[model samples]
Target: MSIVETVTADMKTAMKARDKQTLSVIRMLKAALMNEKVKVNHELTDEEAQAVIAREYKQRKESLDEFQKGNREDLVTETQAELKVVEKYMPKQLSQAEIEKIVATTIAEVGATGTSDFGKVMGAVMPKVKGKADGKLVNQAVKSQLS
Candidate 1:
């Protein structure tokens, strides 16, 4: 099934289970997906759906950080719960070691020797690692390999 269909089914399940947190998060995701579809006037492919989920995950991470810094433990807990729900739809994350291996191989493939060639290496690497690895981790791995 498409992501939209899966999400709809999950939403129904959440509602029936009285899982308010999961239901709310799923509704938010649905809205974001719908907005993207409306924006482009086309249904999103699986990749596009993954992109939306990733974006939402990133937002939740930021909120978690901000809440922690502001000493709002309640908000932090809430955001963490929301993040957990959002993550249920994400692709399995790559381990740091796995990411490092790919980054090293990508660097060699692109002949990236120093910081000057960072962009060249990144342009070639990001697509290969997309959705599976976090961008910050990839950037750090690339920097370590290049430096």
Candidate 2:
């Protein structure tokens, strides 16, 4: 099934199982997806849905970091749980090694010789790596390769 359909089915399952936390996160995801559809005046494709899931996952990660920094273990645990739920809908993340390999190839393809070509290399690589890897990791990999 498509990601959207799977999410809808899971929402029903969460309700049936009386999983409140799971249900809340699923509803939040559905809301985000629906908002995107309304904004674009069309339903989201699988890739677009993946993008939404990735965005949600990123937000949760940020929240988790902030909670940890503030020594709020309770909130950190909560955000981590939410992050796990959000990640279930995203594409399998690429490993750092895999990301590095792709970045290396992209740098060569773009003739990126130094940090000055970072933007050029990133533009060529981001589309290929989007949703497969996190942007910060990809940027670091590109910088290391170019520098």
Candidate 3:
């Protein structure tokens, strides 16, 4: 089944199990997917559906970070739980070493040298890593490799 179908199935499972937290997260995802479908006026491809989930996961990560910075333990705990639920649908993330290797190769391919070529390197790297890696870590990997 497609990711969207999987999300629907999981939503039903969450309901049957009375998993409130998971149910809510899945419902939010379903809403987002519904919005995207309305916006595009068609069913979403698995990639497009996954892109939406990745966007949701990114939002959760950002909120989790902000909550920690504000010293809101309760919010942090809640966002962390939400993140775990969202993460079930994300692609396996690339490790630091893996990101670094990709950055190195992209730099070579693009002939990027030093910090000045930062944009060139990043432009080449982001698409290769895309939903498989976090942007901040990928940025750091690219910077460290360049400098």
Cα deviation of 82, candidate 2, in Å: 0.5
Worst 10 residues of 3 by lDDT: 138-147
User: Distance (Å) between predicted and true CA of 69, model 3?
Assistant: 1.4
Q: What TM-scores do the predictions have? A: 0.97, 0.97, 0.97
- For model 3, the superposed segments whose C-alpha errors exceed 4 Å read none
What would the per-residue lDDT of candidate 2 be over residues 1-147, giving only the tens digit for each residue? Answer: 988899999999999999999999999999998898898888799988888888889998998889999999999988988988998898888999999999998888888889999999999999998898999999899888887
Alpha-carbon shift of residue 119 in model 2 (angstroms) = 0.6
Q: Write the per-residue lDDT of candidate 1 for residues 1-147, one digit (tens) a residue.
A: 988888989999999999988999999999999998999799999999999989999999989999999999999999999998888889999999999999899888988889999999989989998888889999999998889
Give the per-residue lDDT digits (tens) of candidate 3, residues 58-121. 9999999999999999999999999999999999999999999999999999999899999999
Residue pairs with clashing backbones, model 1? none
Off by over 4 Å in 2: none
Error of 1 at 17 (Å): 1.3
